[model samples]
Target chain A: MVDAGVNMALFAVVAVGYLALTIALGIYGYRKTLRNEDFMVGGRKINPVILALSYGATFLSTAAIIGFGGVSGQLGMGTIWLVALNILVGLIIAFIVFGKRTRRIGKRLNALTFPDFLGRAFNSPFIQVFSAAIILMGMPIYSAAVLLGGVNFVVASLDIDRNVALFGLAIIVTLYVTYGGIIAVMYNDALQGGIMFLGMLILLAVTYIELGGVVEAHQALTNLSPQVPQPLSDAGMRGWTAFPAFGSPLWYTFVTTFLLGVGIGALAQPQLAVRYMTAESGRSLNRALMVGGIFILVVVGTAYTVGPLSNVYFFNTYGETSMQYVGQNADMIIPVFVNEIFGGSLFGELFIVLFLLTLLCAAMSTLSSLLHTMGASAGYDIWRHVRANRSGSHTAEEVLHGHDKDLVRSMRAARIGTMVMIVVTVIVTYYMPANIIARSTAVFMGLTAAALLPAYTHVLFAKEPDTRAAKWSIVAGTVTWLFWGLFIQANNANQIGLRDALFPAATWPGVPYSVIDPLVIGLPVSTVVLLAFFLYGRRKGGL
Target chain B: MLGIDDPWIWTGHLFAIGLTLFCLIYGWLKFNDDGEDDING
Candidate 1:
């Protein structure tokens, strides 16, 4: 896009202007962080729009646009099913059912972090510690996923070297998050979400118009079925506009891994759940719901739409489908499409920079939220309990029930925890395999869902909230997921290399077990364990 | 109907729009309800 001097200068001016605005917001968030409460959840008084925007922005990162969007280009419109579930489950059910209760119960418990919320609710510090450990370990994979999406876009569009772009992006996110925590994260997310929403809507309309119209665009992509690559066709890819044939490996991966894994797994995400606690009241969350819904639709819906349809543009232009054109890295497709269509044209350079800004903001929003959650879990849930209890003045249990505890050092500890996690995340990002964004996201989300969802739901609704049921269910879910992920499912087994080292091949020769997501097996097992234990608890009159 | 003939694909698109519209109406209807009331507790 910056091939000419005039365009390069305009790009620089736009980049600088965007950076100035971001820095200003960062400073405002820093000044606003006068207390630990403000640092964690914005004093529990964040407005509805900001809450909605923050939630939406954090939910749909560059991973969604750059990673999944590229997959849509490669795979087709079947990914739209994910958008449907994202709205119904991720947005609607989340706000109306989970959010209201989380806000009310969070306020009642005086919980500052998600693990703290669980720990206080279940009256088990062990639950807090274990869940915190889970977040600390699993979140880096997702963080690396987001980090790579942003870096890849930078590498593709700006022609920057991969390592420099990776660390540079990481550093900018770190500066804002470490200083101001969730306040900085949410405020920046609001602006970022707004810009992304606008950009995507325009991109969607233009992409369709560029291809001829909505119907024309769809027809064009549908007609590319003959060119659907050989292995993919063998794996049941019908076309860009159709779902994979039922019972095929691609279908299992599509339905189980992407659609169900990401869709349902969104509920128990600590970063997203923590956002509900930021709102002042259920009414604010209620008002924020539709805004979040639309933001998701326009942002994710557009990405999914534009991605697969990019094939039509490429086919018409380059005489190859997107997969054939981009080679093995589906990650490069969207950025390449953006550049080819937008770069080197009159006034296209400015739009190109804005698109880059949208992606950077997305990476920042999601990364900051992940870092903050990890940091809070480490500092407040794990370390504070250990460190603060050394004095023996008050237990974390007593502190949750309204006993006052000094928290000044806890703030410093959280920032330090954030820094440590950032280093780990940067290392993970440095070595992450290519085209891993979507799969890694599904892995992390599925892990959280399996580990926390059943227990979390039980605590939300049960008056007495049986601790034994929750505790064992958490363990059962986690073990099942890990065993399947590491030993059976090629999706993770291939990445983690446990199954490969142990066995000759990644998966069994017999069936589709390799592609079936761990969530399918883990969640049901977790739920059964929870129900069994809860029934026993009730029979024992523990309720 | 939108040129993509697959029932699953079109239905998925319609479902997404339908859910978002439902959320929009729900938000408007419940905008001024009790801010702190909770049935769960």
Candidate 2:
């Protein structure tokens, strides 16, 4: 229920204040954004702290906290391994191994976007356009889901009209993104990131305090293993406190789908990768690494830790698992816990509204960045390239240095592109079923990994990047993952329905290759193809 | 170790802390080093 403490007026004052601050920042970004470079790459000199926070905010959308947090609530704290991966791979390897090189080369190539980076690296227009096309095609489903996540939360918490929240949220975020571009996105993301960090830290402290300290709470949770649901136990989950049984079905899933899929897939994300370009130099990103890592840990680690422990709280209070209280909806676990944590008192009431702001920050931060990426894919990558090729304009220097008249046209096109993509995302949100988009994130991640990662990594590291091999490798990965997701990966195939539409006898995925993530397959397929070409090229002295 | 028995789960927790420190120290160490390149200016 909407808290009695949180009336419309209180929320109104808070929301208005928050929006005012956000718009003030946007205007600041607008004033600072003089050239196209400012709009696209925050003039390639954004503060390290802002860049790091922006990257974290963009990476961990509202769906991640609520969705994955709920999963940990249901499945257990085993998912916290993703936090390790987020730091080890997502931040450390990403910033040190990949971020520095991507920034250096991106500057050298005068690339403005992820697709542009890849394209200029290979000197392949097809690579740039096709990569952008993949983003445009794949990202909308995820963005729509983010929009839905925010809208649904607003409807439930504030008791506002869903349509109003959806449109209101979209229009506000889209305005800043279109006008100020990445400068605004990064600056606003820093504020959102701070809010998220504060929210998570509060929840963590309150949770531990309520549970009588960390060890006691965990012990309480560990003692409740006997309350495991029959279906989950039978499926190889031992308990909430322990790992799923070795080599069990649950083990396969936790390892393949969430662990490797999202853990590695994070490395290839276009929105996150673009942040590497906004920093001034390797040293700036090096500085960003510490802030980025801690931010990720505080937010993601708190969710995973508090999630499983919630079982103890609920069981102690109501003799029910976290699942039982939420009627088996994993997404509600975190929200319900938050509402129940600080219930009834005046301070609790105010904190409830503050937590709601965290949700708003999470949603808008992610959505704005997604909007920015989609816009760049459309305007700067696809449209600009096509137009420039035909009209013989946008020389790399012109676009990079940002002094030419044509650059203004290009920037205008990007603004138009941001508006168009935001509308597309909102339309998708309006039409697509929530259930479908909610489950589509992993599939979307796998798709990006499959189609882009191998080629992207090759261009970054390879001394003589073979454009033909890179092209074919991308095609091979895209085709392989598409075929897999449609006909092999159980969840996606079932959603797409083509596999069973034709065959009609394929059972749900389990115990075999169907259970493997598409990225696991797609990345290898692309890598092997590239490797073969690499060997052949070396033999022939062509690459 | 902290009331959870499974070494696996606790190891993940420890590793998360370890990696965060790794990033913090690395960044701190590298914050002042501009390296041999990007120095012509």
Best by TM-score: 1
Against the true structure, candidate 2 reaches a TM-score of 0.88
Return the DockQ of model 2. 0.52
| A5: Cα error in model 1, Å | 12
Candidate 1 ranges with C-alpha deviation above 4 Å = A1-7, A23-51, A180-188, A385-406, A503-509, B38-40
lDDT digits (tens) for residues A1-543 of candidate 1? 222112556768999999788778867866676555544356356667876776677778888888889889888899999998988888888888898888888887878888889988999887888899889979999998898888887777777788998878878877767554534555777888788888888788878888999999988888889988899999999999999999999999999989998999989999888878766667777777868778888899998999999999988987877777776688877877777777777666677788888788778777887988888778777887787578787776764443334465666777789888889999998998767888888999899999999999998988889999999999999999999888888767767877778877443633588889999999999999999999998998954
Q: Report the Cα lDDT for residue A26, model 2.
A: 72
Give me the iRMSD of candidate 1, please.
Answer: 1.3
lDDT of 2 by residue, A185-252 (tens): 56777887888888899999999999999899999999999999988888788788898888776787
